[model samples]
Target: MKKLVLFLTVALMALPLKVKADEGMWFLMFIERLNHRDMQKMGLQLTAEEIYSINNNSLKDAIVQFDGGCTAEIISKEGLILTNHHCGYDKIAELSTPQDDILTNGFWAKSKAEERAPKNISVRFFVRMDDVTKRILGVTNPNMTEAEREKAIKAEIAKIEQENNEGGKYTVSVRPFFQGNEYYYFVYQDFEDVRLVGTPPNAIGKFGGDTDNWEWPRHTGDFSLFRVYTDKDGNPAPYSPDNIPMSPKHHLPVATSGIKEGDFSMILGYPGRTNRWMPAQGIEQNVSFAYPAWVEGSRLGMDVMKKYMDQNDEVRLNYASKYASVANYWKNRQGMIDALKAHKTVEKKTKEEKDFNKWANKKENKATYGKVIEDINAYYAATNEKSRHDNYLMTILRTSDMGALPYSLGSAFSQYMEASPEQRAEMKPYLVNGINESYATLALPLEQEMLAKQLQLYATKSTGFDIAPYVKEIGSKSNNDFTAYINNAFANSIFASEEKAMAFLENPNADVLNNDELFKLSSDLIRQYNTVPENVKTLQNDYQKSYRLLVDGLRKANPDKKYYPDANSTLRLTYGKVIDLPRGNKVNDAAENWYTTLQGTIAKHKAGDEEFEVPQRLIDLYNNKDFGTYADENGVLHVNFLTDHDITGGNSGSPVLNGKGELIGLAFDGNIEAMAGDVIYDPKLQRTINVDVRYILFIIDKYAGATNLIEEMTLVK
Candidate 1:
């Protein structure tokens, strides 16, 4: 075991010390050894230690994982955070009311007292990370089944996490890299008292709406401000009046110097997930079977939600976050479908796998890797139709709150009913709180339509698999139309309304819940989703082992290629240069320009347009040339720019820094042409779209008049 670990470690270290200019999400711990010299040659001015030192303040201290899903950066000495407006959308919507609709009108905290802390939102600062590969692999032998190996690893990980968590002061995560061939544990300190400081109106924050999402030459002011608060001693604490703005170890300096094409740029953030090492068959499964179902199901939910959201402000507020999430993924999946097919991704991967198979068939290597490719291909081929069927049902649970309630809140209520009087007394308040919270975001009419339409789609689209039995029974009784059945279910089920739910809670009855239509359907759907055949389970276990071996074997086979692990919601650095794509008639801008400015934004404005409406104040400021000192040397305010830095979903709100490690922009989106980037990095087409820092300042100081925020930041003139 020791020899194997040593060999693996030595192989990884001995790989040619090279760095791709704009393609890899690199681990910070190895940067000094693998990337520092190349980075300096390209234009980096900061030492590698200055970027990720644990003994001293470094750039990593300012970067945080925002609310677990996005990235954010500390931009002021007082721990002011800067992130994409969309990343902050849920909190903004939660803080808004019809009378004080910050989601529509925008918000600026004139004083710290006015900043609002939304519940369950927290920022996690990376404390440190280190390799744990040897410790993890020490417990398992090559002969162990995948399931046994996973159990052994989980036990080892728990011990490691307990040892490094500093007695619960830090959140510890042991993440697999190179498809479970290597392991690294990250330590994070979570600050729960993050508060909203400022944001632009939806008209500016989401200027292009669905039509312009993922496209280039964007003018969206996609930035928001927040602040992290701590106890007086600068320790993490829950929200309280006594808590003070945190004094962070480091905060980024805002660079007033504008960027240009071919200038060096770097992004540091927690990018969610990428399947860059996926096999050819896996790519086929996603593009052909899985994503189409997801796209269709998402569109159905969006259409239903948007109809009611358009009619009432309250409904819109409740559904804003949900709707945005579905809509974004709907477009993204469709784009992935088109992009994957257009780029011939599966074909490319197939060729690579063929080469790998040729190398693996050698007599010396045959025993280990001989069956790996065949097993992976067979598993995916067997599951393609099942994958399509599963995604359709999964989409319902993802999109509709009611569709998931039975397994979540409804199941809890059942347990509460069965509990002893003393236990019930203790659980009742929590149950009521859960009910109220779920109902707060639940719009019955919208949910009903969404549930009904999704059921219809699932019944018709899921051709090979048996859907939930209750759903099929309902369909049969209603002549395959689910509207009347769902309407009747909603009318009669206690889960349908807060009033009925409260009444039921007052006098709990198991029989009543058991007989309820909505509960029965939800339970049935969840049960079907969870149930897997024994054969499929065995195949899955086999596939897992083969996949891990494939990754390890690939590395051993190819020693000269610069390999980096796929992104897995860990802090990573990707450096590149500002770059441009040909305009190609899609954007009404100069063909050679890499950035969009206020003039082009005004040109696209339309009065009363949901997507293109420009705020009068913004137009007035533009007309008056009130860009202040935020404008470029050309005297124009750049709204957004492009960089060829590798990034994906969770990289939104990541600080785009210059060579000096100064904040230049916030990465918010990627070009539509490179939608396949999550699966494969394309150097020629992939571009990271960033909201310019100058534009962020212009909105705060000139447009919104939040100079209080400006005064807090350290700026480079």
Candidate 2:
């Protein structure tokens, strides 16, 4: 039985350490060893089933879709819920007023009545999906012409949907995972009453803030709490005073005595994206050029934004989010590059690729397999040319000057330049077919301003041939200093870079700004982008195509492998018994991992510090027997749980469950070393950072003294 399972795994998976479209080379084996199962066992996962049964009395009525975003499992008979702190940032930020800094001070429901309302926050659940893979692929045989297969599959999916009855509130989403290796259908139940329940101040929740972001051996307490509500009829509704808490099937017990290193664990939530199956060349390009270049460019741009934001409070407020987003991705890319350099993930992968290809060729699997891999690699290589299409198509990497004028122009012409044929069907009259919408989003000169800052930052931070030499070499474009040139561009450009534009914005003399037809046109373009986000539609279609190719291919070749498609932003079951990955010996005198300890924080604390010190509650908990149960190898309470769970940004609110499928921790950030997994998933290095349920419970009971919230749930000490 083990051999059979092993064979099936190696014959069908995207292994953590390999790139086989039809096998789990190493990852599948690893997961199997952890006693993890695929979708077949998903139905048998009682916790998951219990979650499903909450919305309805039967699993049959509980719909789970793959396309669903913001995954939420029913936690209690009354709709009290759980998710990550960062996931609720937008809602918290929205509800916070100028005088009330919920982000900094944090907010907890004093009682049920104190849960703050957020207009835009939402929670969604998977409803259902009809496995239409056979119908989808039936029209396109592996032997069929590519064009013929494409047409047939399209017709088939449409037909399937047309024939099936869909719940009015539900929507069908087809996602591509493992590149173009697979596809799956997801149905979802979206609710609008998500509210902020509790969040630690940024000092703790986002401890170390951006500087510590995307880093590992991390100490960030990245959990924020929220609650879900439903209409009186027990359905999703926009937030209203009349709305009440949602009814859930279960609320996880707070495991005060937390997990041991080798215990069973699982993370169930919406993981954004993972590229564990890219060909070697793709890896090379990323490590050598793509990631490094993007990181450098982003760092420069961020420097500029920081300067302006620091000096101007209004500017800071407006751009804090924008800064975090770019910085977040930049941090991830840098981490990946660093980790790739630190270890031999790329080398091992390359070696494995060679072995797989050699074996497949001997088995006569090469003729077709060889060409496909070759095509993907060659196309990837060709597209990544430094100054050409591959990595430099937009010049956005090397040059971050994002002026509004250019963007406005790009958005205007994009009506004709909009790229996707399918997306073209839904394009606004002002949109260009091939042009990117962001080009016009900066018509307000947002890009140019962003670029100006980027250039200034590069000028200051970089040296050698990379940036310093370039600035020095520009020598003076048109009798102006770089800064002056930038100012002129924003002030003079037709993309509304003048005093009049600002004056109009301040008071609103749109008639003057739009006296010309061109102004009217640009206004319409901006309006459309703000309203529809049309580009999303086109991108979605491409993913659908990519998904179909990948999943359909695997289904045809490995039907008996018990495949679980790559995760869509939906509720997924990825189970694994926890395992410790020791990178190296603690330098005889030093600790191997930088955990959040009283000693570490106390030593680091200083007078008049910019960041806050560790909360006293933690110190008291450590000194007293206040800690309920969790402890590390040294018997110090492991206030946090960490693991190499395959995860990403969107997995923020994900619930890290024990083998019993009870929530043990809330999935938040990845350790600094694990950032590379954002671009490259190296099981040995990438880890998910979670707040130990015990620490949280202790903080609530012994620290914050919030016994009411603690008493509401079953906490197993």
Candidate 3:
């Protein structure tokens, strides 16, 4: 059997002694060994055991995976969860009607009964984690192919999960780290009966909107409140009127003592993917092909959705989350492109790879690591040949709702066909409900235009792929006008009408689907889409294998250097100090500070500009300085502050803790200057933009007048 050797503990002597404290997303498990002493020296007052412990309730129990994407932390013993407003955006939108419009006017429950319970909303609490490397590696051999090794590892993981889950009472997953160099299993307890507690209006929750999203000196109060409920026994259960408020094992105390420059700050949350070890060629492909297509397609889709959204409040509410989600990445991709070029990231990676290759070519290491660089480079070279066309097709396939719907519906319908009669009957209501909900959000004119535009882009830009032959024939018959062919297809297709779809569902049959033109188009597109390009997966496997070996080689080469696993949606801890960025080669030291206050927010107020509009109630409070105890010594309510804490996408709602483990802020965004931080960390320019916890309290107590919610929290002065 081939064993996996992980560099879990790197010697302090292996690294430069004077390294900056702002770069890594360190794992909690190694804190005692690797980070505790430095952290204590940097002003961390809590012991490593206090932060993470299996024998007792700790900080980890207070954090959760919010709705599978963002992070949230418990702030009260009754399980009041605080997360980014954008994280709860869709749920609030779903609960909103034209009459209620919670998303526009904001919502605050006066009592427990008044709170709204949205379906499919849940929070996952981390129970425990165990290193499962030996068990997984025990199932594989060096002679096995990549696919075989993967299969063996998966089977072993499933076995481990089955044995550890205690009969589905817990959610267990074994995640790979350092490119499969290590494995660890995390067990979680999920709470399904979560309710919406409160949220500020869009004017506050999304105050700066797209323009101020990854920028500094932001004034957005990007926070929302929810509460977890469970059975009387405090066990996970589905939503029921009988359920009671949960008493969490632990909760973070809110700090109102304020912060100064160079104060210690830390964040712990599940950060999503980061490719810190990516080869130069991968960066080149992302910049040249993948990211550009994603940006263009997302922008195009957003434009179509925006036209409808602007004209109708209901449409706006329905697509608000979708638009925000798309717009975030569109801006992020643009920033990444600009930053990668500006920072010369590819050049940096190439130099590092050269050094790695030189080290690998040494006599003792030659057999195991010598070919890694060559293999990775060749794999990327071959895959990059069709990368452009692949990206264009994939973007259209993913972004254009009209183009993707039939295919999505078809996949479900295909499952229904293979199901037994009893099973088919069981699946009917769900399938019908899905079709209805999907159709309700779609508009024919908007969808038609989107379909036509995306197909045209795909046809013109992508060379290797072909559109459906039937559709192409129809277009050729109509003087090569895709518009006519698509219009006719919509007119004749069952998918274009909910009534027709429902009518078909009353007596579902395979022939009806087989004969449907839209279904044919979907089938054809999927057929071509599934056809694996020659050598794509093979080269991809090569790249992954070589990448793993490259990481291993680096570990061997620099045995003394500290090594933290790349972010893979796992809980991580990063600590740093709050600092102001230099403004054009000099720190902006005009008493402007590294934080923003309500005064600055008022200064930027433009009455009708959507991005700059301040709510009237907020204005009133600011004018009167009625921020209560949430204001600084100067009586100004701080809105946002900058910290050097390392964070990425899924850390959106992570609680920013002070030295004493008190919640001071919520990490939401990263400054544009460090947009390439996912690939390369830039200590001087990188900054984590956080919404000050005081601002959250100000909005909840003063602006929204939801003092009932504030009394539940433990506040430290």
Candidate 4:
């Protein structure tokens, strides 16, 4: 009897698991079928069609993919956009100079014409989405090789995209979902003339700095304003002096009525990626090998940058965004490692896979799904053995941005060498442009130290000796020290000089690159690095095939259950409620409220600490309880709040809307306790941190004195 019960439980693995209301990053198109009933029960007043409609203006129209990464929302018909401050951090840093430090002091345009129009910043609106699963899968079958299957699917997708493009006006993409078991086509219109409208100083924008990052009782006013400009006809266009503000089809109305402990909330945005279906072996490999190296490499880079940034304001402005970008993920990886371990994520995944194996081995389901689990495990095992070397090398080459310059520049030179004379002439200008752009950001003193540091670590730690030839030569010449070698290499290398690189490009010769030490080292490193991981891609391809089969078989085996595809930088909607986490459920047992207020910011203030310092005006406002109409019923000004909305990295700056589809807050970070959300969704422990809309209004209206910007928003009391 006990055996029978256990067998039944294993058989259930083939069935779909019920998703919690706050668990899934659901596709907007399927809300009516999959989630609308649950959402309506949770107090959603808007219909599914109102939330996501292709025929008419809907909430979906207001949301935009900010800068190809974060999310943003249209707040007014005039195309005023709102997103997280960190989403705009890179642009702010790029625009800042010692003489005009907009990042440190903050900037607010009194009128539309005064706004700073930064180059290359763009916002993309989701035009529409359709499931192309049948059209994609109909082209090929399991009998085909993975490469052939992909080729066939790619052809179909190209045909579909071409058909739906409506004369190439829309940017179209066909992305695979559910481990390639499904596919969806998305259309977007990209507006390139996004301009910075207003932002608070770094002190307010990044209030608690890294210290309060991913923490609960947050006070960060992590919001920034931008505007989208279009052609006179309201079509997407490049930045032009004649361009006008876009008149969007839909815009979110700001809600000032405030929220309660369990008020309904929804997050709509392009959630980057999640691996909820990742096998136990995959999680173990990431936690044990890949993530640790990334964390270490990023920390090493940040330390070098910080040392230079602190001493020179110019360097500080230049590297601030870089350091923050690295530091954000460095800590996130550590958090994920800790959370995954504490949650016993691998054990849970192992049990699921074991159950899946049992179900797959059943007589009725034996043929197609029989070896899926075994095949997945085998591929993971083969890749896991080499993960350490792959991760270490990748972290150095990819994460250590400055150290990888030689390889990047060399790749350009190698292409030039291979190109025909005509092709070389056409590409020469691009090479010069790249070198100059790289030089503007590259600080030789910092790069030398960073390169030497990574080299020493790589030599001591990594098992592969692909870079040993260059390291050995440098070591022999410098008497076993890398500093002198790096110094000499940079001092004499054309890559380190704009003039030398340009001069070399003018009358470039393949022999000159062959003789150049840095170029040769870069070429060898690129060659060897490419050669080492050649097998891993094949293993991953096989895994993708097996994984798709697993998902397909599981779905067929259990027609009663429902499933949502994993996030892949596509528009997804996750809805829940604004609520506080219960104390002791997390590693930290601090009593966190559902929301924070201006009073909390005051309490956290320290005299001169960069992280805790409050602006004098803000302090005075708090002291006098002068928060204006943005204050809640209790006369307290809210700063930030917590929610259970399922969000990930790319959900940053996602609009948090009320039951009536009114904008209430901006989704910024997930709690540290739920950092493992990418791998395993912890419904009970996960919390989405957001900056309260009332707080955004207070800062914009009273603090920044940007009443002109405020007047552009549609507000609801």
Q: Number of backbone collisions per candidate, in order?
A: 0, 60, 1, 0
Pairwise TM-score winner, candidates 1 and 2:
1
Instruction: Kindly report which residue stretches of model 3 are placed more than 4 angstroms away from their true locations once superposed.
Output: 1-19, 415-423, 464-481, 585-590
The per-prediction CA RMSD against the true structure, in angstroms, equals 4.7, 9.1, 4.8, 5.7
Tens-digit lDDT string for candidate 1 (337-448)? 9999999999988998899899889999999998999999989888888888889998898888889886676789889988999999999999889888888878899889
Could you tell me which residue pairs clash in candidate 1? none
lDDT of 4: 0.81
lDDT of each: 0.88, 0.50, 0.81, 0.81
TM-score, predicted candidate 2 vs. hidden true structure? 0.72
Candidate 2 lDDT score at position 403: 24
TM-score of model 3 relative to the true fold? Answer: 0.94
The 10 consecutive residues of candidate 1 with the worst lDDT sum are 1-10
Model 1 regions lying over 4 Å from their true place: 1-19, 588-591
| Candidate 4, 268-302: lDDT as tens digits | 98887677777788789889877787788778888
Give Cα distance to truth, residue 280, candidate 4, Å: 0.4
lDDT of 1: 0.88
* Top-lDDT candidate index: 1
Provide the global lDDT of candidate 2 against the true structure.
0.50
Sort by lDDT, best first: what order?
A: 1, 3, 4, 2
